[model samples]
Target: GRISEGSGEDPYLGSAIAKAMVKGYQGKDLKNEFTMMATVKHLALYGAVEAGRDYNSVDMSKVKMYNQYLPPYQAAVDAGVGSAMTSFNDIDGIPATGNKWLITDLLRKQWGFKGFVVSDYTSVNEMTAHGLGDLQAVSAQAINAGLDMDMVGEGFLTTLKKSVQEGKVTEEAITIACRRILTAKHQLGLFDDPYKYSDTSRPKKDILTAENRAAARKIATQSFVLLKNENNVLPLKKDAKIALVGPLANDKNNMLGTWAPTGDPQLSIPVLEGLKNVAPKAKITYAKGANITNDPELASRANVFGLRVDIDKRSPDAMIAEALRNSKDADVIVAVVGEASEFAGEAASRTEISIPQSQKKLINALAETGKPVVLVLFSGRPLTIAEEFNLPINILQVWNPGVEAGNAIADVLFGDYNPSGKLTASWPRNVGQIPIYHSMKNTGRPAPAHQFEKFKSNYLDSELSPLFPFGYGLSYTTFEYSAIAVDKKKIAQDEVINISFTVKNTGDHDGEEVVQLYLKDEVRSITPPKRQLKGFKKIFLKKGESQRVTIPLSANDLKFYNSELKFVAEPGKFIVFVGGNSNAEMS
Candidate 1:
C-alpha cells in the first residue's frame, strides 16, 4: 500500500507489482481465512514530493496528474483492490484526507472505486498542521470527503460523533462510513470470528518456511539489475579467490530493507553465508572496509532506530588498509557497499544521494589494488553512481534484496541464474537530474539526444538525461531484435494495429528478456510524451532459439484527458517502438 515511497515511481511497474500483490493477497474471494485485504496507497501524487522529501507538498497541473500519477491508483482499483490509503500531501489546495474533489469526485464518482479509504498514519490530526483546521473540523472534513477510517489519529473517534451532533457532518455520512467499514469486515468474515487472523499456532506453521524463502530468493533475483559488467567480470569461477569487503558483507540484519521494524533479522542469511552455500569450492574472505558513512552527523541520524549503521572503532585509513591487504591475494574483489537500509526509506531523505565518501574512498583503494572490482551495490533507491561509473568496476544494483539476498546474488554471480530485472525507476547520474525519466515531452529546440547544444533546454554540467534509463537492465546472455513490422501504417477507431517482431537468444545461456512496446501519438491536440510503454512480454528462450512475438494496439491505448478533461484520442501519425528497454529502437 505504501507504493509511493522507495523506487516504485513508474506507473507501469507500480501497476504490475500492485496487481500481482493484490491477487496474491485477496484473489477472487475475500472470505478465505488465508486471504488478506490489499490496500493501494498514498492516493494522488504523493510520490512526486517536493525535493523528493516524504510527506512534502506536491503541486502540478491537472493534466499531468491525470496522465502520469493517477493510472497506478486506477489500476489497483480496477484489479479489485480492497482498500485505499489517503496521502499526507495536499491535493490542489486541500489535504487529500479532507478533499472532497479528490476522494469523492475523482475517486468514487468518476473512477467508481468501491473500497473504503483510510488516512495515512496520524494524517487526519496532522491536517491541522497543514493549516486546515483543528481536530474536530479536520475529522468532520475527512469524513465528508469520503474517508472511512482514521489511522492512528483518533480524531474520528473523538470528534466525528460530536461533529455529526452539531450538523457540521451529516449523520448519513457517518452512517455510510461505518457501514462501509462493517461491510468490509463482513466480507473478510471478521464479524463472524474477529480473531481468525490472530490464531496462536499460525506463526510456527507459516513464518519464513523453506518454501517461502525459495520464493523470496526467486523474486529477489528478478528484481536485481546488472548496471555494469565490463568484459563479463561477473560469473566468477567456482574456484576463484573472492575477497568480500564492506560493512554489509557479514550483516545478519538490515537485509529485510527499510520499515520492517518487526522483522526477525536473525532468521535471514547474510551474503557470506549465502555465497558459501552456493559456491562451496570458492575461497571467500571478508573485511569491513568502511562503515555506512564517516560523517558523524549523518551516521547519527540514520542509526537512531536500529543497529543498521555500525561505526567502526578503527579509523578510515586502517579500515581501507585492511581491505586492501585482503584484496591482494584474491582473484577478484566484491565490495558490498551502499547506503544503509535506513538511509533511504520513508521520512529519511538525503540531500546527497550517492555512495558515502568513506566507502567511496575504500572502493577507490580496492580498485587501486589492481584486482577486478565487483560492486555489489545495495540501495533502497537509485543513488548517484556516476563517480563509480568513471572508475573501472563492474556493478550489480541490488536493492537490499530481501531475506535471501546472498543466495540469489550467488545464483547470478555463479551463472546459476542470469540477471533480467529491469529498473522500475530511472537512476540519476547526479542530484541535478533528480526527476528525470523517459516519458517527457519534446521541447522546442530540443538538445541532441547524444550531446549538448548551446542555448537549448540542456544543462551546462550534465546531459539532460538519466545515467541509467527506465526499464534498463542487463543479463549474462545476449539478445538480438529483428526488424519490426506493423499490419498497417494507419488505422481508424474501428481497426486494431498488429505489430510483430522476433527476439533471438544469441548467447550460450538460456535467460529471460522483458520485451517492451512503446507508442507515441506523433501529433496531438495537446503535447504528449515522446513515448509511453503500452505493453511488455517476459519471454524465456534457450540458447540460439528465436521467438516471434505479436502485440496489438487499439484506440483506447492512445486516449488521454483533453483540455476539457474529456478522455479522447486524436488520430494522427503514430510511432511504435519495440526492443529490450525504454531506449528501444523504432523500425
Candidate 2:
C-alpha cells in the first residue's frame, strides 16, 4: 500500500512507478467507470522527515524544495494522477494544509493540477498543532489555500460553512472546492455510475489478479539493486545444491513488508518458493538461523500486526550452529535477512538503521562457511549497509517488493532481469545525522576534505558523508560517461541552455541508466547546496550503443529566494555537472 501510494524516494524510479501506477489504476480512458483515483501523496518534502519519523516538521529552502522534493510530485502530476494529498508538515512556518503559495499559487495556478487537494487524515485539524490557527480559522485558511477535500476529518464539511457565513471565507471558495470535487467525480464517471468500483464481483476477479501479479513481479525484479557481484558468483548453477539461511528464508509474512493492507502474508511466495519454482531440480535447504528481533517486546509488537518474529526460544549459539551446519556442504548460501513488516512506514521509525545484531551474527556465522553468500535484503527504508560492502558476498537490496517479492528476488538472482533501481534517499552512516540529504544548505564555513575542526559542520564520530549516496545503484552491466557539453556557456535572462552528454553502455548486457543533471549557484543572495539535482533522464541502451541525452535549463531552474523572500535568478557563472549519481560528476 505504501509503495502504491507514493513514489519510493528516487525521483526517476518514482516517476516510472507513478506512470505505471496511474496507468494501472486509471486506464487510458479517464472517463472509465471502474477507474480508481490515483492520489499523488504528501505533495512536497514529506519524505524529508526529521529522523525519518512520520508527522515530523520539515524546514527547507524554497530552492531545495523545488529542486529536490517537488520534482517527483510534479512528475506524478504530469502523469495525470486523479487527486493529491496535502502533508502534515509545515513549510517555512506555514502548515502545508494552509500554505496558500504551495496549494493555490504553486500547485493549482502554476503546475496546472486540475485535481482536487485532499488533506492528510485530520491534517486540517492538526493545523492547531502546527500553530496555524483555531479549527474554524484554519479550515477557512486551508480552503482559501486551494484545499478541496478533507479526508477522514470532517473539518471541511463542519467548519467551512460557518467560516463562509462569518465572512472569514468566501462562498466562491466553497464553490471552487465543490466544483473540483464534482469535476473529479465527473471524470471518474462516479455520477453516471456511483456503484461502479463498489462492485463485489470486480474485487474478486481483478484485485491481485494473475496479470496484476505478473506486473508486480516484473516491477519488483527491476527494483532490486545488485550491490555487489564479485567473481560473477550470481546466477547459481541450477543443478547445484543451495542453502537458504535466516528466519525469513521461507517466511511469507516478511515478504510483503509494511503498509500492505490487502496483501495476504500466508498467500505470499517466499524466497524459497521462488527459488524452487525457478530451479526445481536443485537441492534447496532452509534453516531459521535467527529471529528477526531478539527483544521480546519488539517481537510482541511485531506480532500485533500478524508478523512472525519467533522470540528467541532457542539460544543464539544453537541457532548459529544449525545454520552453519546447513551451509557447510552447500555450493552457495543465500542469506535472506533484514527488517520485518512493522519496521518501517507511517510511525515505524528507527534510530539505528542497520540489520539487527542477532541477524548479523547469523550472517557472520554463515559467512564463515566459506561458500559464496548471496545476501537478499528485505527492507522499506534505505539502510546502512557499508559494512556489508566489505563482505565477500553478493547483496541485493529488495525493498519489501510487495506480494510477489520472493519471486522477484529469485528472478533477479537467476538473471531473469538485470537490477536497475537506485537509492532514492541517502543512507546515513549513523542516526545522529538525521534529515541529511544531498541538497543540504551551505554553512558559513563549510568543512573541507582535509580540514577538520571541533566546531566544524560535521560529526566527530562518523565521516560527513552518506554510506550510500542518493542515485547510487549498480547494474550487472557497466556504462561509460563522457564529458558534458552545453549549447551555450552563458545565457540571457529568459534564454534556455541546452546541456547534452553521451552515455555509452560499455558492458556486455543491455541496461538502463539514470542520467543526472546538477546545478550550483556560484553567486546567490541565499545559500544553496554545493550541487543540487535539477534534471534527470532514464534511458535504456544496448551494449556498445551510445545515446546522446539532452536536458534544457531555464532561468527558473537557476532561481533562488532573496533576503526579502522573493524568487530571483541571479546572473552569474553557474557550474553545471552531469553524471550518473550524486558523487558522479562531469565538469
Best by lDDT: 1
lDDT by residue for model 1 (1-587), tens: 12215336566666777778789999788988899999988787888778777888999898888888888888888898989999889978899899999999999998898889999999999999999889999998999999999998999999977897898999899899989889899999998899988989988889788899999999988888999998888888888999999988888667888887788777778888888999999999999999888777877777666777878999999998898888889999998999787887787888888899889999899888877999999888888999998888999988878889889888888878899998877788999887888888899878887787787889888877888888899888899999699988887887788899999999878999999999878788888887888889999999999999998998887788887778887878888899887899965
lDDT of each: 0.86, 0.80
Clashing pairs in 2: none
Clashing pairs in 1: none
Q: Please, what are the lDDT tens digits per residue for candidate 2 over residues 1-587? A: 13223555444456666777777888877677556788888876787766556788888867667655686777777888889989888888888988899998888887788899999999999998778778888888898889998877788878877887789999998899899999988887878988776777877888789999999999888777777788878767777788888878888887776766566788788888998888888898888888888988877766666756876679888888888888888999999999887777676777787898889888887776778999998788777777776778888889888788778888888777777887777877767765567776779867876557876786677778787777788887888889679998888888999998899999877888888888777876666677777788889998899999999999877876566656688878898888877877786
Q: Which residue runs does candidate 1 get wrong by more than 4 Å? A: 1-7
The per-prediction tally of clashing pairs is: 0, 0
Alpha-carbon RMSD of each model: 1.6, 3.6
Best TM-score among the predictions, by candidate number = 1
Candidate 2 to truth, TM:
0.86
Model 1: lDDT of residue 422: 89
